[model samples]
Structure formats: C-alpha cells, structure tokens
Target: MKRTLFAAIAMAAIAATSNAVLADTPSHRDAVAFVDQAKIGQNLPVIALSIAKQTVTFTTIASKLGNAGAVKAVSDEINALLPLYQPKWNENIAQAYEKSFTEEELSSLASEGRSSKYASKVLAQQGVIGKQMESTSKPILTDLVTQALRTVMSKTP
Candidate 1:
C-alpha cells in the first residue's frame, strides 16, 4: 500500500510539472505575446457588453423587470466583472493563435504585429478563426450575462 501511494504521488508530481512546462512552451509564449501585440484584449469589454445586450434572455429579463435601474445595474455589474474576464478571454485567443500558427509564425507576429508575413494567411483564415473564438467565447459570455442578471435580481425587490 505504501509503495502504491508513493507511485501515485510521483505520477501526480510529474503531471503537474509537465503542465507547467507545456504552458511555457515557445509556441504558447509567442502566441500570448502576439495576442498582446495585436491588442486583442483591448476591446474585450466592448465585445462583452455587445454580447450581453444582444442576448435575448437578458433583454427579456430587463424588460420584465420594467426598471431602467435594473438594466443599468446589470450593465454596471458586467463592467465590474470585465477585468476578471479579460485575462481568460486573452488566454483563449492565445490558444487559438497557438493552434492556427507555428512557433516561428507566432514569434514573427509578436514582433511585427499585423505586418508579419503571416498576416495574409491570418486574414484568409479569418472566418475559421472567428468561429473558433466565438465557440469559446459563447459560454463565457453566457456566464457573464447570467452572473450580471443574478446580481441585479438579488438586489431587486
């Protein structure tokens, strides 16, 4: 039993170390840098707000509540939560970049921004990339709106 437990602990440690190493791989780091260089996270709040506003459930709830104050409250809550959401969104975009481009391409993009030789390839794959981003972001957006609604409702009469 002691030997089995020791082996289990050793396996867990190796898994944890491998995850840390993978996260700092050249491609992953370059992807993150490229995301920053492209200013991808700068408009996240705006996009989140847009997504929230477009959500039918959110609008229906606000209309049923029949209070501009509630709408504003939800908006305010979303704004407050955006800072926490930004890093997650940036990481998702970075993962997308890592999947779509090689380490060298990511490094060049990070250094050169949109003027990199890979820019045209990126543009050509815009639809695919957009779908990938949207697929990942949909759940996060849903959660954001749900959280905002909950906050507003909890404060409501």
Candidate 2:
C-alpha cells in the first residue's frame, strides 16, 4: 500500500511539474501529432495496471502493520479511493496535453505521425529514451535532493 501511495504521489507530482518544465518552450506540433497518430493513448491501460500493482503491494505492506482485519480495511480503503481518483487523474492527463501543446502543433504532429516510417522512427527513439530515463531517474533525483539539502543547510547559518 505504501508503494502504491508513493507511486501515485510521484505520478501526481510529475504531472504537476511537467507543464512547468515545458512552459518556457513552445510546444512541438510534430510531437503532439505523433502522440495522437501513434495511438499512444493505449498507454492508459499500462498506467492503470501500474496503479493496480502498486495497490496490491501497498496492501501487503499495510497487512504487515497489524492484523488481517486491519489489512483488509486498508486495502479496501485504497481500492475505494483509487476509483475516485482515476477520473481526476485522467482529466489531469488530458488537461496536461491540452495545455502543453497548441492546436497547430497537434495538427502538424498528427500529419507527421500518419506516416508509418515516421511513426516507427518516433517509437524507436521513444523506446531508447525511455530506457535511458528509467536507468537514470534514481540517480538524477538523488542528486537533486542532495543539492536541495545542501542549499538549505548553507542557508541555515
């Protein structure tokens, strides 16, 4: 349960900050089109599955906190709340896309993504990039946290 909560929290934080990261740059129309044309929306199922897996993991952790009844209670609570959060999470995803890209970019990206070659190229690149990111995220996050702590400590004096 703890992992589920942490994953959800992490995803939410990423969704929240993603826009800010892009705010300084113009949206890539080709990218937006690619997202649409490639049927990337299929990832929603992956996201849902990830959440479900986290919930089960969380339930196990919660079970360890007390008796079996307490475990059931915690697990039930997570299951109940997750459904409620799903709609909002989905909306936030849509809004993030809408806010991040302009209509023109989206249209252009759509056309670009229409080509099988272009779509394939994009997907291949995405796979490589995703792997790199997965490998590096922990180190990057750790560095940032360490930097932040140093900044705070430096200011304390």
Candidate 3:
C-alpha cells in the first residue's frame, strides 16, 4: 500500500511539472512581442469601424434616425471606445501567435523586425491565424456594436 501511494505521488509531481513546462513552451511575452513587431494590432481600429458599419443594428439605427450628425456621433463614440477594447484585441492576437508558432519562431520573427521573410512566414499562416481571431473576436465585436446601438437608440428623439 505504501509503494502504491508513493507511485501515485510521483506521477502527480511529474504531471504538474510537465504542465508547467508546456505552459511556457511558447511564452505569452514572446507572442506579444511578435505581434507588436508585425504591427498586427495596428489595423484593429479600422477593423472595428468596418464591423460597426456593417452591423445591422448600426445600420438600422442610422436609417431610422435619418440624422447624419447622429450617425457621426455614434461613430465617434465607437471610435473612442476602441481604445478600451484595443488591449483585449491585441491580447487575442498575441494568443493566436502563441498557438500558431513556436517560442523560437516567435522570437526570431520579432527580432527580424518585420522583414519580407517574416511577412511571408506570417502570410503563409494567415488562414490559421485569421480563423482563430475571427472565432474569438466575433462575439465580442457583436456585443460592442449591439451595446453602442442600444445606447444611441435610447437617446434618439
């Protein structure tokens, strides 16, 4: 019975150590650095604005109000809120980078400073990265647009 208990304890320790090593395999900081170096988050505002414009809630509100100024105000408000959400978006991008590349690859890409080769490597993996980001961001963006629309609608005359 003592031998069995000892074996169980040893196995538990090994499992915990293995998980710790796996968790750090592709460090989050390395992934974030790679994303920054690649300017991956630079277009987040543009993407957010585009999504806002395309959302049915936004369009319906604008059309019902028939006020250019109101539409612009809502757009401006959304843009203002973008900064608050940008960090979350960037963190998601960093996670995508971590999942798609190894620690060595991310470090190399970041150190290369967005060279053509680095761009090609990233471009090659765009589908995977894009899918990951879209799946994670869709709900968040939808909620943002929905809330903005509700706020505007509440204030409309």
lDDT of 1 by residue, 35-70 (tens): 778776565555555556666756766776664754
lDDT tens digits, residue span 18-106, model 2? 44434224343343334445544333333433343344443444344444543444334444444444443433332234343455544
Model 1: pairs clashing at backbone N, Cα or C within 3 Å: none
lDDT of model 3 at position 130: 66
Strongest candidate by lDDT: 1
Task: Compare the candidates by TM-score and give the number of the best one.
Answer: 1
In candidate 1, stretches whose alpha carbon ends up further than 4 angstroms from where it belongs are 1-21, 55-57, 64-71
1 or 2, greater by lDDT: 1
- Quality of model 2 by C-alpha lDDT: 0.38
Per-residue lDDT of 101 in model 1? 82
TM-score of each: 0.71, 0.34, 0.70
Ranking by lDDT: 1, 3, 2
Better of 1 and 2 by TM-score: 1
